[model samples]
Target: MNTQTYMQKLELLAERSISSYSYIHSLLEELKPLLPFAGACCTNIDPYRLLSTGAVVAHNMESIHHQLLTYAYGQEGVHSYDNMTPSHTSVMTLHCATEGQPEQSSRYQDILQPAGFGDELRAALLYKGSCWGYLTLFRKQDQSLFSEQECQWMVEIAPIIAKHLRQFSLAIPFVNEVKLRSPEILMLSQQLELLSSNSDTHHWLDVLRQHEGITTSALPRSILTVASMALTDDTIFDQRLHTDCCSSSLPCSPIQVCVPVREHDYIDITAYALYSHTSSIQLMIAIQSASPLDILPWMMEDYHLSEREKQIVDQVIEGLSTRKIADILHLSPCAVEEHLQSIFAKTKTTSRRELIARLLSQTDCIISR
Candidate 1:
């Protein structure tokens, strides 16, 4: 085929293969005319399990097929292939993962003598830092040996196959092992969202504190942070109106406050803050029901903000001037101002007052245990 035609055919084949279960078998059948192969099979390699997915055996060899052949080769001990005897039984497919390369193994002696086969090749499929599975192709006695070109083709296409297989596996829903939000947390999140939409800073804070108390009573490890943006522009700076407060004796995790509304070319600014404090200025608040150290990972995952932003946000909320924030964070005041500009842009608040009010208002609803 011409290069363009070949490329088009490859794309069409890939789309078909991805769409149906029988496509792989059909693929092998098509390739048989091009390469010297009797049959082929695909298997998925879990940590302790090998599952055969698609298989095509040569006529009348169904009883001793390639699927069973490969499985027997992998199993603990059958002693049928003497030359390829079990040198390693539990070779976890780590080589494929580390190098992003496929490993090929073949034994002429074993194939010719005990196995009564001509030649075989095993190609490992690696994708996304894991070994997805392997593909095995066989040839009969009269057939020609697999060429270097064929091996290279198999290696090149292994990643594509692995990706497709991974996607297909993920598409299969696991009804038996699904997680859902608890009724209480769902209700509490919704109630907090509602309260945050309407309340003032002071009232929101009180409600948030009560909610924090309840949450601590239930999930002793949970922390709450509330902020108010009641006077802040929700479009520019989506801030919280109230956040839960906790005592130093019963410290909560440091809540990283994030405002997503962009302003002045910034997306959002985030900072870690204490939930309970003695200040009345209340620009932004961070609450913790868990230890500060324990909260960092959660903050990273939950807010998806960087450490630098978190530091800046924390300093800003603590009533620190831009210079102070820069000094503490070891950044130039100009740099701090740049980050703040981005923060203001993202939060949609032009000034600190508006930012704080918005944050405080949003965190108004909280459920204490």
Candidate 2:
């Protein structure tokens, strides 16, 4: 193929590498005809495992020969050239791992030699900062040894195979671990859905407190923050009122809930300064065993969002006004206002300026055991 055509094919194959194992297997199959080798196989070493094999075109070799190659390479003890005994049949594996290139031996000298095999070339597969696996090729007596050009070609494609193997390792776990029918997360999701529609503030507070209790019971260390307004009408709010309630024992923090106004695309704000939703209008629950915000950095890194949205949120704790934000971002006043509206609704905040203050001040006291 032409250089440009080959590069284009490589690019397409790289994209397909991010997909499923079956797709990857198909890709390797397509690339096989271009090589001098009789067959190819890919293996993964992490967690010490072998992936699927690609289509191979072996000459006068039974499928058992290929199976034997896999068995020898797949074992934990067969990692290096020095460790392997110099057996004629298994010399290909040791040569590949040690030489960092394909190696060949006479079929007569190796077990395959007795079987009328003329030459064998083994290629080591390296990936993700470690040796992944190997691919072996065999030829009959009339066929020549693997040419230098063919070896170079195999080396060129080895890293691509490695890259795809690493990607496959990551993609598979994500697919397998996803909950296709998670009743618990689904039930919680359903409750959140109900909460999106419920307008009765008192009823919502009751449900919120019950939910908090249930969630907290499962945690080893838990802290709950409810809206101050929810507790203002209750006798418990006044009875427990003390200097320590907002400081020494129960630290007061504000939470803002921005509900979309019915008529326009604007949001209405509800601010709560208490941690317990049992008697509060808004609440922020902080499960104290781990910091939820610590997980945010990783989540943000994996997902894509507009630069403007990221900048606005990053500076939220700084208490910048929409006008000031507009000037800083070089955006129009109306555009800044629109961005702020989306931010408030998504974060369930009433005002952009108070977002940080509320997050810091809102604390749930964890009485140590």
Candidate 3:
């Protein structure tokens, strides 16, 4: 792609949300110039819930491979997944499998060859230092491996793509079809829908709106700003304090957050920071409120943390010191430390501060905005 077109497409990936089918298609179409390929697949990861969502835009394909590749980051022995590390965007060729000789590998013989694709380029959608989503582009059997220039370009744009996806995930619930209480509300609601609608989520939302006349509209600008603050809260605060110690004037973009709006207990909003080259805009997506008081127990189910470990992390988020947490839980300081260590291992945090920030950011959206 020409420099102008390349930058323009990358901008599109940043502006668009990923909840709709067309959104996924547009993402692939935009990237075609960089690595002209036969097809593409996207994986959206929700680290909070340990969930991964897959969307594919391929013709005459089976579902198993798509399902497998969607969660490839978490799965074992997936070179394509491992290649797209935070430091680099990688082009993985099936003809040159990392597992062994290409002809001996099952993935190459069964999947890549059958699909007539030889090369796979993965650009992991990362946010907050986690692989939240993945975009994989494929080439025809006779196609050459992706060039290093393409890899550099892909890595450079990965952050922007991830930022948009985070917004898309946050915006999904906000654009739900709400009952139009007035003409003004109706007009803005439709605009919100057009601006940030997800295909499957919007379909289900439309059904609910038809079933029950519940009035919904875009969040006010004031609340959107608050939700954005509440959503990011301490996470961004810490990032700036630690990462931007020297570059004090360079402000970070306001990333999206999911949170509950005030007074209206039934409404939940996903606040997004729409970043541009020159400036950024705060957007709010509203949905029904159903946030739990404590998410530790629920997260334990996903992370498989023992009850004792969950209790320790719970106390950590409550701002209790390790000794205080130990006394409260009737455990020795050493025992508390052990559980904290385990919690850190399972949740992938290095320190108490990081742990609390991670968990709180995940649930703060529901607590208040």
Best by lDDT: 3
Native-structure RMSD, model 3: 18.7
Q: What is the Cα-based TM-score of model 1?
A: 0.35
lDDT of 3: 0.50
Question: Candidates' lDDT values, in order?
Answer: 0.39, 0.38, 0.50
The candidate with the higher TM-score, 1 or 3, is 3
lDDT of 1 by residue, 2-54 (tens): 33454455556766753223444555665666555665655433311222222
Superposed Cα deviation of residue 15, candidate 1 (Å): 2.9
lDDT of 3 by residue, 1-369 (tens): 565576667566555633433456666776676568776766555434222323443533434343344234222354555555545443344434454355554565667767677666667677545555667777777887766677777766666667655555444233223422221111112122234445544543443332222234322322323333433445444544465334423333433222222222223323333322332332334443434333333345345567678777778877899889988989999998888888888877899888777665533332211
Root-mean-square deviation per candidate: 21.4, 21.8, 18.7
Every model's TM-score: 0.35, 0.35, 0.48
Candidate 2 lDDT tens digits, 1-369: 644565467667767543323434565566657755454434332312122222222344543443243234322233332132223122243334435322232222444555555555665555433333445666655766656677666666655665554444333122112111211110111111112222343333333334222232221100110122223324335534543434422324332222111111111122223333233222322211112242222122222224576577665556677677788889888987787677566544688555444333313111111
| TM-score-superior candidate, 2 or 3 | 3
User: How big is the positional error of residue 206 in model 2, measured in Å on the Cα after superposition?
Assistant: 49
